[model samples]
Target: MSDLPILIAGGGIGGLATAIGLAQKGVASLVLEKASRLGEIGAGIQLGPNAFHAFDTLGVGDAARAMAVYIDSLRLMDALSGEEITRIPLDEGFRTRFGNPYAVVHRGDLHGVFLKACEAHPLVSLRTASEVLDYDQDGETVTATLASGERLRGRGLIGADGLWSNIRKRVVGDGAPRVSGHTTYRSVIPVEDMPEDLRWNAATLWAGPKCHIVHYPLSGWKLFNLVVTYHNDAPEPVAGMPVTHDEVRQGFEHVSPVARQVIERGQDWKLWVLCDRDPVMDWTDGRVALLGDAAHPMLQYFAQGACMAMEDAVCLSAELAGAGDDLEPALRRYAARRRLRTARVQLQSREIGQHIYHPAGAHAALRNAIMQAKSPEDWYDAVDWLYGSTGLEGAVSREARTLGPE
Candidate 1:
């Protein structure tokens, strides 16, 4: 089995997590990254219970917890007035019920844990600066061409390359991803710089018409991560360009003063044109499968993009390892199990973005009413299913049998 390694494209969170999961399952694989170094650009993400459980399964949940800030509660407020409408406790009770706390961490820090795991494992090898150009799959082998003119042959190829996946082009025909008609501005600020009185150990969301802002501490309370998204007639910023302060302010002219304060704090920011694809029909073709953003690119609304990818890595690895000699069918069954769950996340992320972030007219009022009607715990219940999943038992029992002799 080692003769034909599993080739993973894109070494972001999903790819590395997949590698780690494969290692834990005794399935060896190689991860190919387009960047020269392994790093992620983004602020903190909320790891709901489901992701937290997967993190524990990957054996990094504790390390991640050490680096993350635990949200004691979640708050929903009037976007324009700053009046707290509802609050949900995310502390001991929340953890006890969900089996994991709502933890937040910078994207890079989380990625670091996964990278360390990969490097320490003797079974996992990583090739950086190796961009996948093309791939071909046969009955027993899959081959990928690198930009440097090198070739890698493996039993299966998994693409975790992210939203603009090159591998997706090979498997699914290219027509650009659908834009959500929303623009997101992200920035990280030192926690100390914010007003002391307002500093709270909570994940807070101020929702307004056509825009919303989420803020929480990251890196053990040293820094705060902030993301603001708004529906706009303004053209989405070009990908990979610096977003100026003026651009951010322009999006939230009519928002609350506190919202403006938060935006102003992030004078320098990066912007992304929020786009998502229809849930992919298939993540595997022969021995080649797609994982994470390559398979599904989610908006930040659910904060499940990384979590889903992490779960995907674990399931893929577990199935492959349990399959023992039958790697091909194992890969197929892995895809079937993961594809449905990820597709739901993909579609659900966009739905949250649409309904929660960019609500219009009466829809905005309904969003506000819902916030007023529910406590933070009520909101927690809404997201319970997502953060509560641990794929180990189900994937092992069902997929293992699916890959067994017919």
Candidate 2:
């Protein structure tokens, strides 16, 4: 094994998972995070079976499962009538078919699981308050300059730095991400605080014209995570901005009474101006590569942003593990393997936001009808390509026999 480390920028889920994946392969990594401590600021995340497969590969499946709520089904309802349009059952048969169960978890809890695993690994070195300001890479190695005026050398570099990544500027040269003309308000409250009638233990989505609301139980059903999104143009893109409960209610005034009832239950709502970049052909330059949002930022409509990033970590480590002394080829292979899949997700997410989640008048009716016609098995088949397995050797896929989505 190489004595040098694979330096990673950003200590979020993607960066830490990359370090853990590398460590499992007897490779070392150094993760630099800008925050004083490692944590996630979001409320909840819905992880499909694919994420659990990645967790199993990273050796943290049990820990992650212990903190998550395994949902019974995913229900999509009409926000106006609050009627169930369709549901994808995640029951025993569904779990058997997918090889893993669907789960919803608090983002912070999931982050902690990855963080602890990385910290316990001897090959992984985590540094907080150490941001990557810039980098210079040659044929053999890459040097990362930190915000503290310190420089670190590594065999290669992975820019897991997220959407507004500094490394993305130097590598892809893409400017700021484009705003989606959508604003999302999110909050978490005690499950007991919600109306007794509204307390359901499944992942449910209420879809209306130009807006939608998604909520599910998290933290072992002790809390409920609610997110409401609508088409509202902000002056500029921002995240985690505080907004009043009234502001959130006003956005959904036209929604059904049931929807309003749920939206009004939360006190504090944080606003986020959603943004993403167009898919690009290159996510790698020489020995430095981009991962997660830095490579392909997508809207939350698909709920695969973090899932894809975790997949990238697994794939990157798998390719690099067998590349011998040549790191660039491995990085190129990783990018090639992920480019099409991530691009599909990026484009599909945008399309789903418009066609499926935000349709109007006749289009909305047609969407609901079409979804209603599909059987639960059909829904499972629709995502078979996504929730399958990666089947990589000497990595998470080492023990698997099939390759699934990215």
Candidate 3:
């Protein structure tokens, strides 16, 4: 590898994970974050066994596992009936089969694990408030322009700037992202404040018509993360907007009484309008490439958005590890390896949002019936391609078999 570090835009989970992955391979990278400090702002995220595998590969598995809440199963309940349609066992047998445990964790806790590792690694350089503005690359190197008008040169650039990436418009020439027409309200509260009967430890989803709610214990069961999503035409996409509890209650007024009770318990809710781009074949241009949400943004239904981004970090680092003088070829190889798999995830996430999360009338009934008919093992088999991982190479093969041709 050259002495010059690879320049990474956006210091979110994907960017930090990329730095960690490269440092593990004896490579150097400079991560530029727009924020003044490195921190994650979100409720909760579920990590499958594949995410654990990626974390282990990056040598931070122990720290991540220590902060996570291992759940026994994933239960999908009908909002109207308050009955579990079916549950996927993520118990000892499942862990033994997948080689890792399923965990639900606060997003900040997970980001903190990667951020600490990146800060400690000798090969990683992290800079905050140095937002990437644009880039120009020659045959030898890429120069990234920062918001402060400072120019930094590096061997290559990785655009992990996230959903509304500035680099994507310049690289792939893709226009604005497509809005999902779904608005999300999320809140986290102390577990002690929650009702005794509602203090469930497992990852649970309450599915209803045109709306759904997901809640689970986080911070080692000290806090609970609650997210409620419904169909509403948000004219524009925004995040961290304050929403009144009454507003959220109105959205779920028609839902089951149990779901209503949960919604009523939450205070100080924050809102986000979901947006994602359609996957593209071109994520690389010369020595510049896109990673994570910049490369393939998807809906949150699959719970694989962050997981896939972390996987991309691992795959990209592996490709660039021993490529020596040729960095472009390594980038091309990374893009080729990820394009189809991410496209499948992107499409499947949309399908899940439309069919499983928010169906109406007859479609809703049929969705419930189909879910109730499947056995726990059958549900596991359906997502075998997602939670199973042997490494980057194994991931490509499994994704190929599961998603078929591009």
Ranking by lDDT: 3, 2, 1
lDDT for 13 (candidate 2): 91
Q: Cα lDDT of all candidates, in order?
A: 0.78, 0.87, 0.87
Cα lDDT of model 2 overall?
0.87
All candidates: TM-score: 0.92, 0.95, 0.97
**Which residue ranges in model 2 land beyond 4 Å of their true spot?**
391-406
Comparison by lDDT, 1 against 2, better one: 2
lDDT of 1 by residue, 1-406 (tens): 4566788999999999888888887778899999998889877788877877888888777777777777888777667777776778887878887888887888999999988888999979998999998898767778899999999898778988988888988877656677777778888898877766557788888778788888888887888888888777445434545778888877677777876688877746888778778876566666777888888777777788888888887778777886655667876777777776666677777777777666757887787787677755676666655566786543434434333211
lDDT of each residue in 271-336, candidate 3, tens digit only = 999998988987998999999999999989999988998999989999999876589999998998
Candidate 3's TM-score: 0.97
Candidate 3 to native Cα RMSD, angstroms: 1.7
- The reply for model 1, stretches above 4 Å from the true place, is 233-237, 375-377, 393-406
Poorest lDDT segment (10 consecutive residues) of candidate 3 = 390-399
Off by over 4 Å in 3: 394-398, 404-406
Per-residue lDDT of 42 in model 2:
88
